[model samples]
Target: MSLPDFDTFRAAQAARGFDEVVARSWAPDEDVATHSHPFDADALVIAGEMWLTVDGVTRHLRPGDRFAIAAGTPHEERYGADGATYWVGRAEPG
Candidate 1:
């Protein structure tokens, strides 16, 4: 699903009570092996590009692009040539 701009995304997350938010930066061509989160997550790309593979579907995400990760869903990622930076919002545990 498509996502709104950064400000809107942040606001929505706040409204949903996502108290844990962080900004992360990846190095050029950085790769992350498959992993899963214990809680739901929302990631918004702020700079450069990211290639994300989730449930065997790969998506190329650029600035202003966003994606969601359900709890315990396996995913992997690769950064673009120029690297990337993004904001991640995590839902509070129930």
Candidate 2:
């Protein structure tokens, strides 16, 4: 199924009590250094690929893939050579 457009997600987020949505584009060789959050986070890949390292386990996620990162977990990410577009969901006011 086709994913909803950004506008649709933005509208939906606007109604939530605590929501933070990010439309992220990662360039080739880019890495989001390991970090931890106090709240839950989710990510949905739109294109290309990304490698998510959570608790020492690395998971490769490509287009149309979705995953959740538990709160307070240490995690990091890397983008493929072709880069990637992804949507992030956070439990925070955006």
Candidate 3:
């Protein structure tokens, strides 16, 4: 099956109580040091690839892959040579 489009992602985000929906793109071979966000996140890899590290486990993410991170979970990110573009939904802690 194919990946969902921005419209589909937006609808899901709204239904899931994610008040913010953003499109994020990383530069080729970019590396992000360990960090954490203030809100929960749900994302879909729509282009290229990325590595997501959370709790010391690294996950290779590709197009159509989905991942989620709870608020304040320390994590790291690395983008592949072609970089990556994703649609992310963020929900603040209630």
Best of the candidates, TM-score: 3
Query: Whole-model lDDT, candidate 2?
Result: 0.81
Pitting candidate 2 against candidate 3, the one with the higher lDDT is: 3
Question: How close is each model in CA RMSD to the real structure?
Answer: 3.0, 2.9, 0.7
Better of 1 and 2 by lDDT: 1
Clashing pairs in 2: none
Which lDDT values do the candidates have, in the order given? Answer: 0.87, 0.81, 0.96
lDDT of 1 by residue, 1-94 (tens): 4656667767878888887777889999999999998988888888999999997999999988888888888999999999999998998567
User: Distance (Å) between predicted and true CA of 15, model 2?
Assistant: 7.3
Q: For every model shown, what is its TM-score relative to the native structure?
A: 0.85, 0.77, 0.97
Query: What lDDT is reached at residue 10 by model 1?
Result: 76
lDDT of 2 by residue, 1-94 (tens): 6877877766665565337888989889798998988877776788899899988899999878988877888999899999999887778424
Q: Write the per-residue lDDT of candidate 3 for residues 34-73, one digit (tens) a residue.
A: 9999999999999999999999999999999999999999
List of clashing residue pairs for candidate 1: none
